[model samples]
Target: MDLAARKYNFIQELSSIDENLLEKLELFLKTNQKDWFDELSIEEQKEIEIGLKQADNNELMTHTEVMNKFKKWH
Candidate 1:
């Protein structure tokens, strides 16, 4: 589906995958988080740290929100 159409469809909260993709993502997160975190370099660590800081401050949005931001722009 077109990304722009996804955005205005939900002004209050961002959009998400249509259940099936999210199920795959949930399984991926469950199985791969350790391998993923372990492979990150110092720079990627710093970026995640920044994101965590923003999240701590309630200044960060969900991954879906970030995707919405870029998918619309791009």
Candidate 2:
């Protein structure tokens, strides 16, 4: 069968699958996919880690606050 037909058949088959099997398929796809974060530079990774830490510490600013702070520059 052609690729489009195969994908359509696979999606149709997915609709009949049980929740446990669906969860397994989801996990399988996630593990098999290439993560974009893995391509980031060390400095970029560290910056993300810092932002995550700040978030965990409740140090995040609201969208309006951030926009207001940077709006002067624009």
Candidate 3:
């Protein structure tokens, strides 16, 4: 089929999906609309890479640790 016909068919098929599946698909598209890392500056990218490395090395804080640290202010 032609590109326009294919797109129309695809939209028709998508319209037949249940509401929950449609919502999930919309959420997935919105979340993945862009590669967030591509929009970051060089320094920000480096900081993210460093944070990821620390996470891989188990050099990260636990949820309880974070809560405890902030408990005083709350």
The number of the candidate with the highest lDDT is 2
Clashing pairs in 3: none
Candidate 3 runs further than 4 Å off: 1-34
Indicate whether candidate 1 or candidate 2 has the larger lDDT: 2
How does residue 29 of candidate 3 score in lDDT? 92
Compute each candidate's TM-score over C-alphas.
Answer: 0.35, 0.49, 0.48
TM accuracy, model 2: 0.49
Who is ahead in lDDT, 2 or 3?
Answer: 2
In model 1, where is the ten-residue run with the lowest total lDDT?
A: 8-17
Best by TM-score: 2
Per-model C-alpha lDDT, please?
0.76, 0.97, 0.95
Estimate, for each residue in 1-74, the C-alpha lDDT of model 3 and write its tens digit: 99999999999999899999999999999988888899999999999999999999999998999999999999
Estimate the overall C-alpha local distance difference test score of candidate 3.
0.95
Give the alpha carbon lDDT tens digit for every residue of 1-74 in model 1.
Answer: 57787666754232455778668867987987677766899899899999899888999677998898899678
lDDT of 2 by residue, 1-74 (tens): 99999999999999999999999999999999987898899999999999999999999999999999999999
TM-score of model number 1: 0.35
Per-model tally of clashing residue pairs:
0, 0, 0
Between candidates 1 and 2, the one scoring higher on TM-score is 2
